[model samples]
Target: MSIVWYYDFISPFAWLQWPKIKALAAEHPITLRPILLAGILDLCGQKGPAEIPAKREFTYRYTLWRARQAGVTLNFPPSHPFNPLAALRLCIAAGSSGAATEAIFDWIWGHGRAGDSIEALAPVAAALGIDDPVAAIADPAVKAQLRENFDAAVAEGVFGVPTLSIDGRLFWGDDAHEFALACLRDPSLWNEPEMQRVAALPIGAARQA
Candidate 1:
């Protein structure tokens, strides 16, 4: 099974760990899957980062330290937590076309003021080495597929941004990311009894023949 890198470009924390994540993906047999985030939040009745009152302060402070630690250059700019629902759909729109979606993912989380404006995405897109993902975003089939991804993420028990799932076990949080990296580096570490039992399950009766 592959690891799913579930993220929304609008999340700063998601942007922060991106460098390491991409590097980790390179070193392991991981398929970086980008899922649209806003749909997940809406389905859950969760507000944007800038909207939540109780946890917002602590979250930003934590994110600042995290960005510094990861060496990601971030400019939050003057913007409310801009919605990336459309962008998320756009990402789904660009599926399997190559690095366009991945590049778009990086730009959304990595650069200046993610979620503020579509224009902000241009520079990040350039950095990812793809300037035109607009074509994918504009397609009707792709748009619907993206919406479906958000629905899928919610159905899968995802509650946070930058969530990762490996072999169907969920890892949610930057702290969990390292664990994901470790499991990917050494599949032998996955000898837990539960997983072994599941893996060993017979698909069909041997006596059927």
Candidate 2:
């Protein structure tokens, strides 16, 4: 079965689940799609968890706990919510090059380096043998490609990062990884009927005209 993994570099959950996702890719055909989380959020008219003070605090604490449980070292960058446009564009430039893509994620999420600009990503590019990282980001084609990726992701009903789509079935969030894996292993699960369907809320309340 083929799976499409829609991911954003700035998502802590996406970074946390990368190892498991990569291992799953080893067992199945997986497509790594780099997308802009900001675009997706804007398109969906939703707010990120980090935008809320309470949720943001909980997210950081929970992320650290999860990282410890998983034996992964995760350090928050000097700042949160840094623009990841350059990193996203670089992934598009990499284009099926796994090493380059992995390095980008490692540099930001693993190393706690803020991925705000191309210059910040220079060391990562050099390590991955990408000689002209700055030029690559400046390439009009690269910029356009990333824009296209964002559009495509919005079309696919992706409202957040770390979404896995298999056979048109959408499984979102890092916590849903096991369920996605189960669906991949058992196609019959995909055919199961929906548990329940809730009617949409009334758009207009009873109007006394």
Candidate 3:
């Protein structure tokens, strides 16, 4: 089976889930898709968790706790919600390989560094063997690919990062990792009556904007 993981470097949850997703590569082909999380939020008319003060604090605390429990090293970059375009475009420039993706994630989440400007991404680009980080990421094709990835993710109904798409099914968020594995092991899990019922459950009230 092949799994497409839609991710943005700005997300700590995506960082936390990377190792587990890598482990899945042992048995399944994993595609690392780099996208702009900000674009998704714009398309969905939503605010990112960091945009909300309370949620921002909670998200940091919660992700930190989860990382500790999972024995993963996680340190927030100098800032949350930093521009991820440079990093995302760099991934495209580097061919979007698993190693390239992991290295970028490590730069941001593991090493706790910003990934916004050319200076911030220079080391990562050098490590990936790209002689000219600026020229590589400045290629029109690289920019277009990142845009295409964002559009494709939106078409796939992806509203968040750290989403795993497998066999036409999407399992979102780090918390859904185990559930994704279960469904992957048993494709029929989604066909259960309750699953179908909840999928079609109607909204009783709509909040007015």
Candidate 4:
């Protein structure tokens, strides 16, 4: 089976990790799965880093720092926390190819452009040889595929974008890319006693809702 990468256009971390993931794809099969970050956050009853004022500033700074460290060009769109639904659907409509995925990422994070609406994403569609992104994203099939991807992500216990799933193991965040590769290189790592112990650790405290 191919390694599954769950991502959202709203995530700069995803954009940061894309290059490494694409490099990995040169040697291994990787599947691009576009998901709604908001849906996952809602399902888990948590706010995104951007949703929290202090965290938002830090997230932006930290991500930029990371990009610089990785020698990757980084730029935030004019507005953030913008709706990614249209862009997500466009990916699905475009058959989720690596080229299309890279193009979309470049359009958003690389160029610092807003992709919240079909009209805004017209250039991306045109680049992908899609005549009408508006119609493409409006298709019922495209909408359903995006929902299916979200549901699959939830089922996989995915909590965030830039998550890599390999052999039923999830490595979350751009920082976890090396961890994912390590696990892939040594699947037995998960079989360690400490790994099992941590996996079964019981919650000792709870916050009342």
Separate clash counts for every candidate: 0, 0, 0, 0
Candidate 1 structure, TM-score to reference: 0.71
TM-score of 2: 0.90
Please identify model 1 stretches exceeding 4 Å from their true place: 45-49, 96-98, 105-109, 117-136, 185-209
Writing each residue's lDDT as its tens digit, candidate 2 over 92-112 gives 877735676688888887889
Q: How do these models rank on lDDT, best leading? A: 4, 3, 2, 1
- Native-vs-model 3 lDDT? 0.92
Q: Model 1, 35-149: lDDT tens per residue?
A: 6566667767777676776677777777877778777675564454666755564555545333655566545544454544445565644454445656545678866666565
On TM-score, who's better, 1 or 4?
4
Give the alpha-carbon lDDT of every model.
0.64, 0.82, 0.92, 0.92
lDDT of 4: 0.92
Off by over 4 Å in 2: 194-209
Q: Candidate 3 on 1-209: residue-level lDDT in tens?
A: 76899999999999999999989987888888999999899989999999999999999999999999999999999988899989999999999999899899999999998898768989999999999999998999999999989888988899999899996599999999999999999989988999999999999999998
Candidate 4 residue lDDT tens string, 36-123: 9999999999999999999999999999999999999999998998999989999999998898899999999999998999889999
TM-score of 4: 0.98
